[model samples]
Target chain A: AQTVTQSQPEMSVQEAETVTLSCTYDTSESNYYLFWYKQPPSRQMILVIRQEAYKQQNATENRFSVNFQKAAKSFSLKISDSQLGDTAMYFCAFMNIGGSQGNLIFGKGTKLSVKP
Target chain B: EPEVTQTPSHQVTQMGQEVILRCVPISNHLYFYWYRQILGQKVEFLVSFYNNEISEKSEIFDDQFSVERPDGSNFTLKIRSTKLEDSAMYFCASIPPGLAGEQFFGPGTRLTVL
Candidate 1:
């Protein structure tokens, strides 16, 4: 079974600054997917960024990016030029691309507060 | 943008009562799933359905829980008898064929069992 771990319980970043949320996972599958999802007060799960285990290059979308170290089993999310809208509970997730159905395995989540 | 939508944004039910949660996945999506998150807990996958059949299910999806796609557009999850432990935010998600890993998630339905 794959398990995602987000060591940081809470994080704060000043507006316009950068913040990195740490995440690690334990999975034996060679080819898999790592993701970072954001949940605001609305409780809607929003996709922030995703990284394919096979892809050596990290994935970046707008201000969100991931630092994926397959050997270390680490996948961390970085939010550059952070804004107030970034305040939310961020969850790290793992999925097996080879399985019958790739169900998501999520971490406890890191509550982020973007202070103005 | 196309997205998954769930009905009854919030539901309140008494213990032992039955409640059905509904979801309308993207029109072109071929895979559907149900997940739940207890207060202050990580989201957990309950079941996944594809081609009108269950592709996978977690141990948490006991006989008391059922899923259906009677209508092509609506996918539903029904709890035979609600329990206090069933109170949580239920989320529906979908992924189009060929997009195996990237899934679109619904806003989620908050189920409160008392």
Candidate 2:
């Protein structure tokens, strides 16, 4: 079984300030994928970034990046130059690469607020 | 870019009434999924459909819940009898044949059961 844990339930950062959301997971599988998804007030789930366990390098997408520590099973997201639009719930998810059923196991999520 | 779409952005139904949530995945995507999120809760997987059959489902998907791909494009999830707990945002996602975990999500349909 796999489980994703988001330690921070809520966080706030001022506009233009950077913030990091923590995430950790428990999985025995060697080959897997980790992801950061953003759900805005509209409640639409949007992919922020993804990291593969096989890759030692982290993943970065524009202002969103992930620090994926494979050995520690930690995949955290860092938001740089945060804007008001970045205020949303961030969820960490996991998926095994070998499975035919591509189901995502998501964490409880951290609600982020960007103050102007 | 191709995207997934869902209908009935919001639906309100009484208890014991049936409700069907519809989704249209990307045109060429073969795998489909349904996930739900209660208020202030994490998103939970409900079921996954592949090749016109259910490939995987969570324990939360009970006998009262059923899914079908009646047409080639539209995937539907039907709840036989709505419960107050069923009031949540239902998200539809789809993945192409070779994609790993990069599933495209729809805007979601908010189902409210009273």
Regions of candidate 1 where Cα sits further than 4 Å from its true position: none
lDDT of 2 by residue, A1-114 (tens): 999999999999999999999999999899788999999999999999999899998899999989998889999999999999999999999988687588999999999999
Q: Give the worst 10-residue stretch by lDDT in candidate 2 chain B.
A: B94-103
For each candidate, the DockQ is 0.82, 0.81
lDDT by residue (tens digit), candidate 1, B50-87: 99989999999999999999998999999989999999
lDDT of model number 1: 0.94
lDDT of 2 at B3: 91
Tell me each candidate's TM-score: 0.98, 0.98
Model 2 score (lDDT): 0.94
Docking quality level of the chain pair in candidate 1: high
In model 2, where do residues sit more than 4 Å from their true spots? none
Q: All candidates' lDDT scores?
A: 0.94, 0.94
